[model samples]
Target chain A: MLAESLALSAVLFVIGVVGVLIRRNAIIIFMCVELMLNAVNLTFVAFSRVYGATGQVFVVFVMTVAAAEAAVGLAIIIAIFRHRQTVNLQNINLMKG
Target chain B: MQPYYSLYYTFPFYLFGVIAIASALAFVTRKSPVTAALWLVNTMFSLSVLFVLLDAQFIGVMQVLVYAGAIMVVFLFVIMLLNLGHPSEIADQRGRWPTLVAAAIGILMIAEIMVIARGKVASRFQVPPDFAAEQMQQYGAIGTVARPLFNEYLLAFELTSVLLLVAIAGAVVLGRRKDTRAG
Candidate 1:
């Protein structure tokens, strides 16, 4: 059971990594980042199953931090969209200057 | 959790695991951010059920409430508010280098999973559940978590609230705009 759950988490996290690599839309990339975080949370909960509730506590803290991150990240995305009228990462390469 | 594994536990565990992976695949591949966000919600729901299967019931419920309910909703709201549903604008095919890198990472991860699935790591780190069971008997599941959270991790917990306050303030400042063009 432990191995299976960990394997599942790994696959999910890999998918998220691939998403972040491939997706052009900034919002979609952010969503993929959320997916990666969720995968890590799953691994934490799975370990907590064997160790104790300490892993679960970490999961709770992770969720809180993720919420905060989402709020700020989306707000930044909104600001960028307002400035450039698009959310495509390919097009938002202002750092090249 | 049963002392011994049974088909009952194994069945739902695999089911939710499959659901989570599939939904996450769909989430990443979808063109429209709105549709992708919805798929992410499904993935989160399946992950929540898997959490319950792992005997972390409170964490499971929080996964549903906080991730599937709150976070995904915010994602969808932003996707819509920005009018991001135009699937055509998104270039669905990424270049060859990213595809190669992603494949390399995926293969490496699969190899790691195969090593873990060999059952050696599981046997070594598998601590007896006596400590957690004793705590659960005393404080129940949620309380088992809460006790440490409010005691040992109290400072960290308080700091998390402060972090959230800063996040909220930062979001408001970033989102706020001066009057320029009337929408």
Candidate 2:
């Protein structure tokens, strides 16, 4: 039973990874990253259930970090879009230097 | 008997697995960012259900509340503000052999790790008689998690608040529109 949960999380994480690598749109890529974070959250919860309270504590902290990451990441995306007028990501190479 | 055991647990796992996979497929195939965002929300909700089945009720609720509720609202706001429909021209992804190869190799490495881990877990799966009942009692409610989360992890909680504050400030700073007015 628990193993099945782990399998589902793993499969979802893999799919998120494929989305991040294969997609060209910056917004979609970031959404995939968020999916990966949610996958990790699922794993943390499963392990917590398997072991004890410690895993749940980690899940809480992870949720906090995920929220923070979303705020900062989206802000950066918006700024980049404002500057370049597109979120293609490949077009923005100003940081390559 | 085997079917009963499978039905008892594996059914929910399979159900959520299907939801997660279908939403992911929709997310990837959809051209509109808003459409993809909606599918992503569905995916998050299904993942939360899997968490509940795992007995992580606190995290499960947080998954729905924070990711599906709060964070998704922000994602949708950005998608709407951008007004991005579909790309006017399909971005050329051809001739990116190296990147594709790298991704395939990375995936293979992860698969290998999972296979190894599965072996380890299978070897350790000697069932104690009361294990199932005890697990049910342990995860049947969230009170067990609340006590320690507020106690031993108190400092971490404070730090998270600080992190959120900084994120808010950073988002405002970055997202504020720059005016072209002369000084």
Candidate 3:
């Protein structure tokens, strides 16, 4: 059962990684990153069943960090959109050097 | 292995597991940001169910409250704010090379997880007998989680708050409109 859950978590994580690599929209990429973070949280909770509440504690921290990342990341994305007028990655190559 | 309890317990796990994976796949493939965010919310709810099945009740609740509730709302707000009208314009522009590379990396990750799942890597970390009963007796669910957060992880807890404050400030700063007249 644990192994099955862990396998599912890995699959989710891989999907998130693929989303990040293949997607162009910044918001979608950010959502994919959130998906990856949730996958890690799932793994932590699964391990907590074996090792106790320590993994759960780590998940809280991960959640905190994810919230912070979302705030700062979206802000950056908004700022970028304001300047460049587009959130597509292919067009925002100001630092092409 | 009581048939009734085993069947009852295992059913939801499998159910939510399938829901999470399916929603996650939908989330990544959706061209519209709002639709993608909605699918991610579905994934988050399914994961919370999985967490609850794992006996991390507090984490599960927090997953719903934080991930599905607050964070997803913020994402939706941003998506609406951006007003990305044309989905076709911002759709995936990557060539086949990225797809192939991503597939290779994903295969490597699955292989690594397969080894671990097969108990070839770490067999010593098996769950102790009556772990659920022992944990319930020792600290209960919420108490067990709170003790570490308030005691051993006290400094980290405080630091996380500080980090949140800084993040808030940074977001405001970055998100503010620049004064063109100042230059």
Candidate 4:
């Protein structure tokens, strides 16, 4: 069952990676990144159960990091949207060398 | 074999698997940001069930509380606030070579990990002899989880609090009203 959960987590993470790579939409990409974080959370909890309590403790930290990430990422997204009027990644190339 | 065996075991097995895969696909395929957000919620719900099955009861509850509850609500709020334009038709995903290469690498890496996981699973599925409640206590009960959580791991926990504070500060800084005259 642990193995099954880990596999599911990995598959979800892979889907997220693919979505991030293939999609041009910034919002979708952010969602994919969240999916990836969720996958890591799944692994932590799974290991915590199978091995010990440390993984769960780590998961608490991971959740904190994830929440912080979401706040910062969304604020940047909003700022960019205000400037460009669109969230399309390709069009926002002001800093491109 | 007991009549409830399949009900207790196999049902969640297939249900979580299907929900995880289906929601993930829907998340990637949907054009509407709200639709994508909804599917992501489904994925989080399914993963929470997966956590329960793994025996980390506390973590399972937090998975629902934190991921499914707090973070996702924020995601939905942003989606509504942004009022994003229609997702561009997933244009033919040009430059196929790089995608193909990445997918192939992913498949190979997953296969390698699967081979390693198989051995661990085989050992885990075997049942151990039943023990009395006293014996279970000797090995430590759920209290063991909290002991370290509040003690040994307290610093990490405090750091997380600091991390959240910084995040709040950053958000405020980013959104602060700029003095237009300075520019």
Error of 3 at B148 (Å): 1.0
Candidate order by lDDT, decreasing, is 3, 1, 2, 4
| Docking model 4 quality class | medium
Tens-digit per-residue lDDT, A2-94, candidate 3:
677789899999999989988888888999999999999998988787678888999999999999999999999999999999998988898
Q: Which candidate, 3 or 4, would have the higher TM-score against the true structure?
A: 3
Candidate 3, residues B1-183: lDDT per residue as tens digits?
A: 311348777899999999999999898888888888999999999999989888899999999999999999999999888887457767664789987898898889888877867764356666665675587579988998999889999999999999999999999989988995366
TM-score list, all predictions: 0.92, 0.86, 0.93, 0.83
For candidate 4, write residues B1-183 as lDDT tens digits: 222335677688679878988999898878777788889989988887776666566666777888778887887777667776355533424267757775776677577767766763466554432322232255454564576778998887788888899999998777554675266
Provide C-alpha RMSD values for all models, in order. Answer: 2.9, 3.5, 2.4, 4.4
Q: Report the candidate with higher TM-score, 1 versus 4.
A: 1
- Residue-by-residue lDDT tens digits, candidate 1, B1-183: 646788998899888889999999899888877788889999999998898888788999998999989988888889889888889877664888988888898789778766766755557666776766676778887997898899899999999999999999999989988564355
**Candidate 2 colliding pairs:** none
Best by DockQ: 3
- Cα displacement (Å) at residue A27, model 4: 1.7
Fnat, model by model in order, equals 0.77, 0.54, 0.82, 0.50
Name the 10 consecutive residues with the lowest summed lDDT in model 4 chain A: A46-55
For the predicted complex of model 2, DockQ is 0.56
Colliding residue pairs in candidate 3 = none
Q: Tell me how each candidate scores on DockQ against the true complex.
A: 0.74, 0.56, 0.78, 0.50
CAPRI-style docking class of model 1 based on DockQ: medium
